[model samples]
Target: MSGRKFAMKKTKSRRKKWASSQLFYEYSTFFRKNADNVIFQVTSDQLPTLNRIGLDDLFMSKGHIREPHWHPNAAELDYVVTGEVVIGMVDPIRHHLLQFHVTPSQVVFIPINWWHWITAVSDDVHVVQVFSSAKRQIIEGSNVLRKTPPKVFQQSYDVNAKQFASLVSPIKETVVIGPPDRYALTNLSDEHPESVPRVVNHTPPGSPNLFFDLKRNLAVRRDHSYLYEVTSTQIPMMNVLSLGDLYLTMGHVREPHWHPNADELDYVISGEVTVSILDPNTLAVCNYRLKPGQVTLIPKGWLHWIIPYTEDAHMLVYFNDGKIESVEGSDILRLTPADVFQRAYDIHAREFTREISSITGTLMIGPPDRPRR
Candidate 1:
């Protein structure tokens, strides 16, 4: 059902909260609204996450084109949902040209900071572009043509006007998103790639939401192509962590806990979700009710929980730091000695339940790499 619209019941009062604003909030799709096309900027709880940037889908006629442009830090990941596209890019070194009859499952990877151009080869071509940096860091760029005339850019880039221009026409060019690529990887703490926890990436397509039961250890793709993993590759970053856009997903509920290691960021892509986070410093509570484009950030070591507010909603999740680990939260509470959580939550032993026995005594723990995703 490519490009088919599915019925999604809108909630009357979608405004709901998980805990308190001390830690969570929601924003709508307005972040990228412009006269041109639609682009949704959603992420949770990070300085860079809330900052919006340009990432959008462009629809072109038989010969429409997105003129040549360049950014210092932005790299585009384009996937053809329908029709064919001709893409060309060049940096200081070499030029690359690829003419592809891309379909639903095909993707074209474009590196960062390369001057690039695209022309639609289909009657109506649609494509998705993901920025290497967050939306915030890619808004202001020198539209190469602005330096001179349209023809100058074409000539400077060695693009043939008569032949190429005839084949590539201008579609729609509008500006509606922000700042630039300002953030840098200041502190990527030391860690071995071998420490990444096993993850099962699954989601059924034809829906905006995706679910991966990390606690229960499950995933449902809904028919959409859910990439489980890419292995044995010699690339620097080969896992989902390297995806250009944030990982968009949703689930029933995430147990109350926190990652002592990394910060977790999320935006309510659609539907409603409540996230409760504990403040390790203040010992108080911070709750958030996130909606479309609204972000919920879970700082490291802050105990947290998440759940669907209505029938079901999708929240965009990404490790702002770009490091991920599959911590077995359920097993921690169930199997770990009472003293551990007792010290963390400052609760009495009487508060513990028999369910803890079922949690701690399970025989199903092992390397989830094979069955994960």
Candidate 2:
């Protein structure tokens, strides 16, 4: 049975339908109407299968900052889509500060429970932060400091209660994103000149900027189809997710494959494509026809494939792991003994051998045949 029908039959009117629409938040409009810097999230609450993966869209204008925050339940993997930003984080375990100047195509990872914040460097900045959970868990710095009571801070730091109270008075509310006012004295650049981010590579010895430039890290292709990935192999600091940008020409396919340990979420960036995912658990199949801005989540260990519906389609895929481990469908089908196929399906041995003999290697992306009209 198809995944859609199975979901309905199993629930039997107890639950509403599983989400079918692609997650397409109008980020530009959301940010413009909101008072502060914008953040839109998509999680299991929005789509059930999204329980294993979540995404947050962040947008900020010049001088604005995303307040320092930490996720207790998920690690954050941020990808810069446009403009520039400086990310600063406090490593509680290491007892040090880590910062990075991130630009388009660059990525950064914040380990779980680490306090981190981002400030836009350009006129406008757009970032996509992916989390390894259905819902993002966050604790803002302002809330932590403000709610602790001035007396507690005074005792802990051996400071005067009156002085500490005055110091923390500005933290009136949880500033999800700041500055409290356009001309506020608490602006990051004005008050924290020493922490200003420089463009130069300032990767500390142990904590490096997990940045990967796609222009430099090219994945060779047989035809026009190509795939470029950033995993732990490329950046040791990456601990949460592996990112990939894939391009496929019309009439080609990103061959069937399954990740051994990661769930894959894809954001279609250009053109159109059709994706098929087969669930091994229930032996059910689901298909999604996607266009730009649409996203699809393939559960972990599910067999899946992608075929382009237009010329030069592009997709950004995120895996919930630092390294990608995949088992290609071609490898499974071609490696089995030829007689196994004949015995299982009652196929003639000669025909089975001939069919299996032609597959030379694991084809990651396509046989390059034209699609039927």
Candidate 3:
């Protein structure tokens, strides 16, 4: 009776925990909207299972800019999903300004505490920014420019206090998407060229390469599925964030695996997919069916796999570690001695060995095609 009661208690506890675990979120319903620009965010606040990883879906129109800002606690990996943008950042080590023109399927890395900004170069631009922290803290340039007293500017730079005050007066609030709608525009020629910081189009030697083209670098290509990845190996500038662009068709599976060092957030771009995760604590398997604009989070070291339900499923997987180290399920089954399996489960050793002989390597995507008898 005691054993039966303990089993029932455990089952009840598992049900309670599963009921509270949130593995799916919709981006379309939860977003911060600006006039012509918008941002959708996913952090620990929204998904309790998230660990040291977050994402922001940002959209901007031509000539608009995502105001200059610096994240105090996170490194950012920006992946361009559509259109083009110019990413500008100030290198603190060299005190140089660097700019890169990024188009669709490209990426730019911004180190933690680096001042950076983005300007849309095309009509419709969508960039997904992945952060290393669950809750990324930001300090906007508008706050710095508006909050500082004009007298301090005059004292430091020897500028007219009244003129400086007038110039910044229009910035009443945090202008996330700039040129504030009420602000007037004026074209003025550069009168003090020497004062302007020289902008460089290319990175200096010995400096981290900040730009990479994901489409050009295909990590894996199969008949029905393909993946593109970006990590510290590809761009040393990537501090603690990495990305994988994945596309899988119906009947295709992202083979079961576990990341030993990094947490994962999967964001669906098109079609539908089902993500399965096995919780180590409760020994329960949870399955989440996600559609376009939906997302799921998998904690570090958790066993998981993805299967597509539609013909053209696309998703982006983000990780908190720049170098993702994973252990594939196929490797474990194929490498384990048949005798060990027999000893553990009382199975026929020879049959187990023969059954797994076909799995000679890491099968990232499975069911190897075999001729039907």
Q: State TM-scores per candidate.
A: 0.52, 0.79, 0.87
Sort by lDDT, best first: what order?
Answer: 3, 2, 1
Q: Mind giving the per-residue lDDT tens digits that candidate 1 earns over 155-189?
A: 67887656554432332233232111231212211
Among the numbered candidates, top TM-score falls to 3
Could you tell which candidate, 2 or 3, scores higher by lDDT? 3
Residue range 1-373, candidate 3, lDDT tens digits: 2211211121111112474357666553233335347776787788767778888878776666788999999989998877788899988988878888888778899999999999876766778888888888989999999999999999999999999989888888888777677533222114433322334458876567898889877877667788899999999768588889999988779999999998889987767788898988777788887765567888889899999989988889998888878898888898888899999999999988877777767777765555222
Q: By summed lDDT, which 10 consecutive residues of candidate 3 come out lowest?
A: 6-15
Best-to-worst ranking by TM-score: 3, 2, 1
**Model 1 spans with C-alpha error above 4 angstroms:** 1-36, 40-68, 74-94, 98-110, 116-135, 139-142, 149-251, 326-328, 339-353, 360-373
Which one wins by TM-score: 2 or 3? 3
Alpha carbon lDDT at 115, candidate 2? 90
lDDT of 3: 0.78
100, model 1: CA deviation in Å? 7.2
lDDT of model 2 at residue 269? 59
Runs of candidate 3 with Cα error greater than 4 angstroms are 1-20, 28-36, 183-201, 369-373
Going through the candidates in the order shown, the clash numbers are: 24, 0, 0
